[model samples]
Target: MSRTFDDTRRWVRFGTDLMLRSVGGLDDDAFAASSALPGWSRAHVAAHVAANAEALSNLVHWAATGEPTPMYASPERRAADIEQGRALPSGELTAWLRRSADALEAGMTALGEERWSARVVTAQGRTVPATEIPWLRSREVCVHAVDLATGATLADLPPDFLTALCDDAVAKRATAPGPALTLRAPTAVWELPGDGEPAVVTGELHDIAAYLTGRPAAPLTVDGAPAPALGAWL
Candidate 1:
């Protein structure tokens, strides 16, 4: 079933709330402690979460005002902002993030659930209806929350979220060829058809996510393929 804006809002809220409560209680030093996502402290990952929200908010304004929106004025600027912001002291950084999240959610909800049908330009330069906003928002919040690894395992994700993520990954991976990758779940498997010579892997959904999003996983093969590259696109 296609998820509605309300559905999206519900899932997004659930995911972000879970993440904040799960990790928000960490002390200042603990906030800087390591978790998933190589080389990025928890603070770093949190910064990206908030920064992206604000960036998307700006796009919402562009959509409402008829201003042209580009994915990134330039990738470099986007990267620079994250790199700098991620280093702020834990207390200040976390507060900034909470502020960003509140503002973003308030702004989005202000548009009214019915308003998502209005056209908005995407970061990718595609013009899609506002209905897509929640999907995009869900992706960033849910996946990145996992990236943060806040002591929460993939098992904590709701069923619909996991299924939706894996299914969407399958469709998006169809045309792209790279390293052969396989996603094995406790109950089922998702096979990605890599370039001409398909590569394969087998692991649980969380394992699949871990590998795709630059986290470590079991001995999944990558023979003549860089299957993990596809994760970057999402």
Candidate 2:
């Protein structure tokens, strides 16, 4: 099934809600604990997700007002913001997360059909229309919720979103140099890098998405062999 912007928005809302729930009621010690993401504390992941919401909101503002707003002044500045936010008191960090998400949601709701076509640039330096914003935000919240390590897993994500994520991951790998592999999911098959007698990998849709995105893929098998290391994505 094709996904519409409305579907993207719903997923964003759902994902953010899940993220909030996962991190809720954390104490400073809990926030300081290491997250599933290597070398990143729970606080670091929370801060990054919060800052991401605001950065994306800036893009929505640019779309609605025709101002040339970039997601960040520079890569260094983005890193600095996340680092500073990570040091916030536990309460403040939680507040920032909620506030930024609320602001982004408001910005998205304010955008009309015409504004949806407004051009914007992603932090990765890709130029895309405003319609891409929801997908970007959805990816962030859903995936990072697992990074929080508060018991959320990729399986907790919406099925349709997982399917879309798998497709996107395959498309991204197709453009980069990588070992040729065919991914088999319950509902779809995608050949990564090229179409050939590639190594066949099989797993649940979300597990495949996780593996392709550089997350754990213990459940995935490559041609009945050990899983191959994936190239960098994002």
Could you say which candidate leads in lDDT? 2
lDDT (0 to 1) per candidate: 0.69, 0.89
Candidate 2: tens digits of C-alpha lDDT, residues 1-234: 366788799999999999899889998899999999899999999999999999999999999999989998888999999999999999999999999999999999989889999999998889999999999999999999999999999998998898888878878888887788878888888877654457788888887888889998764465367767887878
Per-residue error for 102 in candidate 1, Å, reads 0.8
Q: Per-prediction TM-score, please?
A: 0.79, 0.96
Which candidate has the top score in TM-score? 2
Clashes of each: 7, 0
lDDT of 1 by residue, 1-234 (tens): 345567778878977787677667766687678758778888778888777778777766655555655546677888887887777877777787788778878878787545556687776677888767777778777777776767666657766676676666676666565655566666566777765554566566776655554456563554533344554545
Model 1, residue pairs in steric clash:
177-195, 179-225, 179-226, 180-199, 182-201, 184-203, 184-204
